[model samples]
Target: MQMNGMNIKPVTVILLVLLLVGFYYYYYYYYYLSQYRFNVPPCPTSCSTSEPKDRVPDVIPTDYVFHLKTPDHLQYSQPSIVKGRTDVVAVTPWLAPIVWEGTFNPVLLDSIYKQKKINIAVTVFAVGKYIMFLKNFLETAEKHFFVSFNVHIYVFTDRPKEVPKVNMAPGRQLTVRSVPSSNRWQEISARRMELIQKLIEEQLRKHSDYIFCLDVDSQFHSRWGTESLGGLVAVIHPGYYLDDRGKFPYERRPESRAYVAHGEGDFYYCGGAFGGLLQEVFLLANTCRSNFEEDAKNGIEAAWQEESHLNRYMWINKPSKVLSPEYLWQDFKPRNPEVKTIRFSGVIKNYAAIRPNV
Candidate 1:
């Protein structure tokens, strides 16, 4: 093409054509092509630096996914050839294989996971009189809680000096963090999630592989060990495990995000004791903390506070394992025969006196 009687060079026209082509290819390869076809790895220091080996699926299904792994050569419902227990059953489907005493071989599991030196982060808060329960809790934990696996009991309390110095066994430790004292038990319970989220992000995530958020006013009585480890674990609340799912005390307020309609819960998990992989526990704690904050801002606290939020999250996320009521028995209730072991029990408390402005 000619402009103002000036002859345009064929080389100039070719160069312009080449520049346009270059721009088109660059845009396609860098922006459009990579997003549609490539799995771009994160750069160092941004987050996860590892490159993905497989192409990520385009669409992830919304339905719950459960993965169960049993010990060698034992049928799901059949009698255990090694232990000769005929009552073994696969409860909770893929969410969590119910961990009973006869269902697992402690020695065999220890030999396998011990090499990993699994660092368990057990977090609990003792505000007010709840501090008194720490001694028995720590002593019993040393005796039964992941005895073979490396364990660190992180006690969050207003009085660090009050935290008992229970003799720790090999591969065990106790850490006390000073938290603000609270008059109300409900306030203390709700704040535990926020404190845990902060700890996991600042410290626990770096040092611990697994994290357990447990109520401080409880003591271990039997083996609570490696068999409970999973991507995420939730314990069945002893009071409501056998009750109809319709009766679960999930948040009933429609405006709250924690609301769960009747007949929706898989299990009524005790907010007092729950845990999982460090990352997953971090997510659970952070999410529950945020949910609690939102509820507070709206001037409507859920009946059970963080516990309500937990049930909502578990319904959507579906924990990898669902621990039976045996994991959290109460001293007040008669021991059910079905509960082969009472690994931990809630100590009797003066709820009226301990609670503030009740």
Candidate 2:
């Protein structure tokens, strides 16, 4: 009601007071006292009172490794037959199932993960010229990679403004994170471990059930379904998977943080793409980042930088699922008969020009 030159109403004043009281009650109950709501439940068993460590551990624990033991019923259809046994398919000594096409049915595999209602997070760092590959990479990924499931593509880029727009499908999303660019490809590559370490600790661990670290310079060409899922998974490098262990270019310097003996190599896993459960991925990122930092401190870089450290870590702590080269094929190589499906292929690039300080 206006008192200067208009009529004042008692009913209007009462209504205004009632509305203010209602808003006050709503804010107090919903915002201030929300924790005591009847629908709120207690924290899960895994919740801990101790604060999370702010820094990476000096020594990574290797006394006990996380292993994925498949039940007898869930074993591969064709078991590795030894010495004339008909129903045997060779598996790694560590029980890390080697995945290839025709070894497992995609339908059933997707169904299992669907039942868990898991959300998968894929992280790819696009820097410098690599940013040009995002259009095709993201579009193809939307069509092929875990098409029926919930997937979040986390694209870390130096030029966030230049990130191209791609139409995302239902139950899928893209997040562009701004990261500082580097002149050297080695620095850009090695920094992934550190960035991912922080991302997992600060953000990803709370949202995604599983996490996949991927190379942006690759494209998905076939179905990269839930068959690749496990507690911890690593893909064999297409270039060195067949190479003899003795000749594998593992870090040989004892002073380097990523040192591995000449003859002590499993399948040379690629650094292009790897994934696992959120917690396990966090451990991997943490370990790799810490190792990379230590190597930097000694003024020594591993032979292949982050990849070298990844190989060393996976060797000491075996991957639960070792994907065949089908998971990561290179366009430079001729398609092999054994590679039933090339889920993702790395495109050729002018490395000397793209990489600084070459």
Number of the top TM-score candidate:
1
lDDT of 1: 0.76
lDDT of candidate model 2 versus the reference: 0.77
Query: Clash number for every model?
Result: 2, 5
> TM-scores for all candidates?
0.77, 0.76
Report the number of backbone clashes for model 1. Answer: 2
The residue-by-residue lDDT of candidate 2 on 1-358, one tens digit each, is 6888988799988998999999999998777655332221232343222212343221111221223223335543454434332233336898778887767766556555665666889999988878988888998898889998999998999889889999988899999999988878899989998888778777775577778999888888899988888767999898887679887888999788688877687878899899987666766777787778877987999999989988887886688898888888998889887776688999887777666667
| lDDT tens digits, residue span 100-188, model 1 | 66777776666557655568889988887778888888888888889867888888888887777778888788888898987667788
The TM-score obtained by model 2 is: 0.76
Once all C-alphas are superposed, what RMSD does model 2 give against the true structure? Answer: 13.2
lDDT of 2 at 281: 72
Taken over the whole model, the C-alpha lDDT of each candidate is 0.76, 0.77
